[model samples]
Target: MRAYIVPMARSLTVALAQYVPLNGPDEVEVLRSSAAEMCSAAPGLDLIVFPEIHLCGDGDDAPDTNEWLNAAAEPLAGPRQRALCRVAADLGVWLIPGSVPELGDDGRVYNTAIVVDRRGDLVAYYRKVFPWRPHETWAPGHDFTVFDIPGIGRGGLSICYDAWFPESTRSLAWMGAEFVVNVVKTTGSDRAQERILARANAITNQVFMLSVNAAGPVGAGGSLVSDPEGTVIADLPSDEPGLAIVEIDLDDVTRVRQHGTEGLNRMWSQMLPGDPLIDLPVYSGHIDPATWRPRGQS
Candidate 1:
């Protein structure tokens, strides 16, 4: 006798904090205080996300990128960052406090995003792989990052300019990410394009795209959240500071990938083991048909 099993729903509650930072010595303290207030207001939040470079100013007014980095950059696990970890533990919520200028061991500054678990532990960190060239001076990281959220789902991390490259989200999706958290600090007019990119990335990857940006006085604040089928569920379309609380069902990713996108396209299922490898001269790499699936699969 064959048995039918019911699949469990994978749901996650997230808060996108599109707040303007003080950009002073008390910035970290402000972050903690604001997070506490947010948690108090919206109880039982699974994750709280901030914008890119929330600790430091967005550098829109800074005349020199190098000078700004020199003034604001701090080492990984610096005292300020370590202090911020307590916010997650105290609130019992996972936190992505945005990217920071990290002074690396090699004496170079990298724009790095950190992930803190509910237990107040720094779980993972991803450096911006695609720094906005000619303008951004931070060193680029070479690897993609994705972290598991215990029983809920796995999440990919990408910083501001990283979303411009399709490969960033694609690589993360292939690595078994059910959702991607893209922290942005775009004070430019290009934010409209970024919103489109956010939806496109979500549709193409069959994963939720949570693109959070900083509010005005610093950033343009066009943060948005897209579902697996490229639907914009929540959008904050102004420079004003606000918080967006969204509940996402991670199992929807599995549903969309298994079936077709709107029952028409099954992009991930196209590649088969029997098919030959497709060569790509630009990257000097080829796609292996046998192992094109997400990480940890046969």
Candidate 2:
């Protein structure tokens, strides 16, 4: 396995903004103002993350109908996106403006996260691969995206339900991602589990994980940052809107993999002797029912 090294500054400052959920025309303005406040409060932050469906608020109370979700969805180049880009530029910071209900050209709505660079340019877009089953109306995303920021190290993007699947983060790590920004919209009941999963993902992948969740009655507001060692470095209040800022060393990713006993990359290389897992023709066909059944089953 090839070792990944950090080429820029050894450390980065990241801020997680636990945004309050509000529904109205002023929602965008509220977020813009909140982001500005966060920036002013914490100067020189390289990245600031918001919650899921931030512009169009998570539909916690709305009817479970596609009509409602499609109505809230907007094109990638819509005004909301442009406004967020402006916010990034004004603050002079890289921004993950959370997930948006995107109205794709195919006429289907997708839960998407748009990443903006410090210069206010849209750098990458990652659609959620897994939508919360039986409830979410958005389509699943087919691709995983990781991109580079000129000064900062490489980062990956994933939305709420995507983090539940280990392959989501694993793929990013395989692609040389040093850190992941996960934007989420979770209820109070799921907050604890979300934190556990965040820590697990960070530890197993040996990468920095920042999870930014929403606030308000519908949201749990447990925005947190986990280090490569699965430690919760910083966290915000679960019942209120706030910002959790922390400084992390990107070089730790390389250091951990190089020195740790059971690093993920080293384990994978050891397990897969020669051919890559994707190149193997396993689990592609149906299994025989009689070969694998419960001991008591007929």
Candidate 3:
């Protein structure tokens, strides 16, 4: 069984992550320090997940997402990621830092989820393929990304807003990802939308999903770890800061997948009016010759 530890995030109930930093200097310090502390909190687990934008108070003055994206962004190998890497190395666990704005070499910003292994090696970088509204300030990621994690099956990654679109998750499933991580920051409205993604993707792809979200502003605090059958094994307390621990066994996923909808999942066909839903795949027969985005974003 793969034991996963998810943070019970404390985010703003109605404000953005940036505003929560205004939540007192000590509070900001604790939020920024959460990942490193996990090294000691639960060292026995194989993996640990934290919410996106864990660094809340960087003294950024930008009023817009872009401005904040640029200002609060971290330099590669900066203190932030390095701190988490050290924890993974010391504890012999893989760590998924939900994600943060990264200032790339060319100075363009990108929303990135970096995966670090037990030895603390940076294995994969899952850039946000779709940056949501106000995110136009940062560059949209050009391609889908995935990689393997020992004992965790072929894991996948998706950042906030990316969950609303089916293409990325399908692309990962198509590429053989067995487990997917949806790490995000959300408010009340967005949280409901994300839950739909978790439930649907599990049924369609036969893959497990583990979500890490913030509690107050950046997220609704509904961190979850679900199976391929779309059954949530464990979850963090909603509207509060707490931890959710789940043991993910590869065999369990294999067994449930083999049984199909009769196994651990809720029948997706039952998704009715206003249900958080995943739509049937749409295959575009032809591109709009006028202004279709080139298949290769380049």
Best candidate per lDDT, number? 1
lDDT, candidate 3, 1-298, per-residue tens: 4333433421111011111322334433454355446555554566677666655434334466567657767765887777767766766767775677788877888888888887978898877888876535667787877777653456788886787787787677656666678877776666776776788877676667777777764457777767777787766647576676566665554554444465444322233444443333465343222322112111
Superposition TM-score, candidate 2 onto the true structure: 0.85
| TM-score list, all predictions | 0.95, 0.85, 0.73
Which parts of model 1 have CA positions greater than 4 angstroms off? 1-6, 58-65, 296-298
Give each model's whole-structure lDDT. Answer: 0.88, 0.79, 0.63
Tens digits of per-residue lDDT for model 2, 210-249 = 9999886768888889888888889885658787889988
Q: What is the C-alpha RMSD of each candidate to the true structure, in Å?
A: 2.6, 8.0, 9.9
* Better candidate number, 2 or 3, judged by TM-score: 2
lDDT measured at residue 279 in model 1 versus the true structure, 0 to 100: 99
Ranking by TM-score: 1, 2, 3
List runs of model 3 lying over 4 Å from the truth.
1-43, 57-62, 263-298
- Model 3 gets an lDDT of 0.63
Q: Name the better of 1 and 3 by lDDT.
A: 1
lDDT of 1 by residue, 131-158 (tens): 9988788889999999999999999999
